[model samples]
Target: MLVKLGVNSGFGAKSCIYMLASSAVLRRQQLVIRCLGVGGYSNHNINTNQKPMQGVGFSSGASLEADVENVLRAITPTLDPNRHKGQAGNIAVIGGCREYTGAPYFAAISALKIGADLSHVFCTRDAASVIKSYSPELIVHPILEESYSVRDEDKSFILEKVLGEVDKWMERFDCLVIGPGLGRDPFLLDCVSKIIKHARQSNVPIVIDGDGLFLITNCLDLVSGYHLAVLTPNVNEYKRLVQKVLSCEVNDEDAREQLLSLAKRIGGVTILRKGKADLISDGEIVESVSIYGSPRRCGGQGDILSGSVAVFLSWARQIVTDENLSISSRNPTMLGCIAGSTLMRKAASLAFENKKRSTLTTDIIECLGRSLQDICPVP
Candidate 1:
């Protein structure tokens, strides 16, 4: 009956229904895109025959590692004295809990150190004060609530309040870095699901890492086919992702192809498989950023990548407009991942060059600006 009603509508009525459905889908898509600072349908080319621009391959002695450096140079916006605040970028990190606050702080502050104008953190009340205390520069929102704090009778009310807090500022953000220090609390995860849905509704780009990966691993629908989302996972996280999505063990020999397939299977969302050489793919093209990094595999480096990617991805989206160029074939998320991975590697290499055995995530973050300056020097 419902199917018959859907089908029996006049051709024009059917077209209207289709258009309405498409508009809703595109609206959700645009919410994320706009949050990343990219304009909507204006950038879409109806022809679908457009091609991407040609580029020089990564130089000799340059593996995916070398590619990262060059891509960083290519995408890092030149610092102009004339530009005002927020023009560079605005980013938010949506993680941090009782168990972990340093991760979100690391991710958010790193965005600032890397040149974003504003950085925000949305964390649990317990973690908020600590993260806020770590840096006066970040705008910390103490909104997330753990289950232990709320009674079952008030769950719906509390959930709505949490959603309201995040939703109020949803459209203002360019990108959200989810799952840094996010703990494995059932109630907290449920709240984050609502937050993800809101971000999706607002068209906000999301970079999932840390415990955020854990949430998505369990509920794949949250990010399944969202093209604007980027997932950064380490060796262990990658292994788990493979197991959950592919229902099998990791195959190192065909890692790149498998990663590529994973992104495709998940609806063209971008994935940055962090490893000896960070492998990135949007299911279509595979790229690697293997620049020499420190031997010291510190814990919070992935946080830096998540934050850095948010900024670069936002910038890439800003530049890939119809007015700027005719070729709209490229994926801004892919470009952002490429540029972010590249910059992080170069910074790590520079940090290692200086700090050597003493290198840390903070030290690498400190090198972000210098790395950018070295790659694409501003006048």
Candidate 2:
């Protein structure tokens, strides 16, 4: 029993921990660890991914021709009963304002729908109540102040309060989805800057989208050299980022090279350029997820991608660190982009199949679970 306890404990576990080949074996191992007072074993191991073990792989294509599905299946944690809340993931979105509540809602709720345990939304006072009304599952915090609401003298005090509020919960979050419906309020953006700095200090991973892209574009220093940061940019946003960082136009002639340059220029932060084919880069390799997708042009799909990536990215990081999964692509952000983009496209296709041309973002969000289960069914 003492021998069992020692191995079951965190002590001398990692070597064998990474070698648990199949989910069935992984599950049995997890249960034994939990029952034997080896709480740490269960952590960073199971309760990620979807349903049962597929014992199968996924499809793919990229600059490196990555086996996207294989990587997805590999890093995805097996769903185990021993895991508890927040172990799967606790994601926070720092976006939403009077003008946009749905973006944040879509991002936050999508995180939960994708299997994140706790999803929090921190938005402006005007947007908080509306977002809360959208769903009771979110832990909405009305803590951000817009430029129109604050006076010049109160800026400093308000900034501190804003940062303090976020700092209180900063370390608790595994990943932050910044700028879903986040408006371009100077005061609010400034406060967000402080929050981003604090998150970086805490070593928290961040997925930036929407207005977060706007802020990071204007101030490249915000995410420069921070490998944990991920930027998801649509067409217009990508143009702005490209122009600002590379000081050049979007060159399809050398699209992959340009993306690699852009990521390298940004000090190796990951970039997911949203297009017909989502291209992902971490300054090292350029990968693409060009699976079959819906032709429907929707407004909020990017928000879903951001939230999805945040959760998957956190999981990929955990699994990569803890389990020696078969991933040639070592960068967690890249793995996340591949998984998030692939899953989003797959869900979008399924939603379009059902909703046809009227496939809205919510429809796509609704398809997330079913789509994942279809690819990797729950046992």
Candidate 3:
């Protein structure tokens, strides 16, 4: 029975008064990556015999390794004295809740530390204070609400309110990082789904990670086929995504081919599969960054990667018309992933050198500037 309803339509299935929410199965379609690239970027497999980089060093001979450094230097904007605030980059992170405050803080602050002019975080009221306490440099909006604090009757109004708040600042952000420490709360996830929709409508690029991947795996419609989207998934997260989208186990022997297929299957959105060597694919080509990296398997590093990718991707997009980018048809999202992964690996290696086994995510964050400077110095 198709019941014609007005007020109940906007509210989801879980809304108060129990209204049926419409669900439509999105037909999977293959969409190509938008036409933006350097002329000659190549796909090269990781060289197992390649010696590890020493102390923020660049690979002297590996073509792919050298290509990564070149991409980083090319996309990173030069610091101009006349440039106004937010021109370098304005990154917004949409995550953080009662159970997770540090994740959002790490992602937001890392953006600023990596030279983004402004960094903002939208988190639950309970997390806003804690995140704010971590850094005065960040702009924290205590807007998102969790299930416990919100009554069902208020969910509709509250969801609209959340979207409105994000709408005000949506146009100002160069890029959005969608999941860091976001917990797996049903109501909060529902609100985030709406936010993702709004972001897509605005044509803004997003970096999905951590809990965002979880939200996306379940609702592939949220990000599937959005070329501006980039998903950074670790091992477990990648496994789930492959199973959900490709219906098969991860084939380590043909990891790049599988990643390529997975990206193509999802409509050309770039996927940065984090592992021993970060494998990046945008359905068109595959690139790997296996340079110097730390052996430490610490938490919060992925948050740092998500934030850094947001900045670099924004910068890459800003220079699409430059004639100097002749490496190949390297999409901006792919370039951002390569640069972010290389920088993260460099910083981690540096941190591990200093702190040894004591190296932490904070230590790695501290090394980002130095690592970048070593690769591409500010003249």
Q: For candidate 1, lDDT tens digit of each residue in 12-34?
A: 32234224433443454455556
lDDT tens digits, residue span 11-42, model 2? 13222322322232345445555666646644
Candidate 2: segments with Cα more than 4 A from true spot:
1-38, 43-66, 322-324
lDDT of 1: 0.76
| Model 1 lDDT-worst window of ten | 1-10
Per-residue error (Å), model 1, residue 349? 1.5
Candidate 2 residue 358 Cα shift, in angstroms, is 1.0
Cα shift from native, residue 51, model 2 (Å): 15
TM-score of every model?
0.82, 0.85, 0.84
> Which ranges of candidate 1 are over 4 A from the true structure?
1-66, 322-329
Candidate of highest TM-score = 2
Predicted structure 3, TM vs. truth? 0.84
State residue 104's C-alpha deviation in candidate 2, in Å.
0.4
Pick the lDDT winner: 2
Error of 1 at 299 (Å): 1.2
- Among residues 3 or more apart in sequence or in different chains, the pairs in candidate 2 whose N, CA or C atoms overlap within 3 Å are 51-378, 52-377, 52-378, 52-379
Off by over 4 Å in 3: 1-63
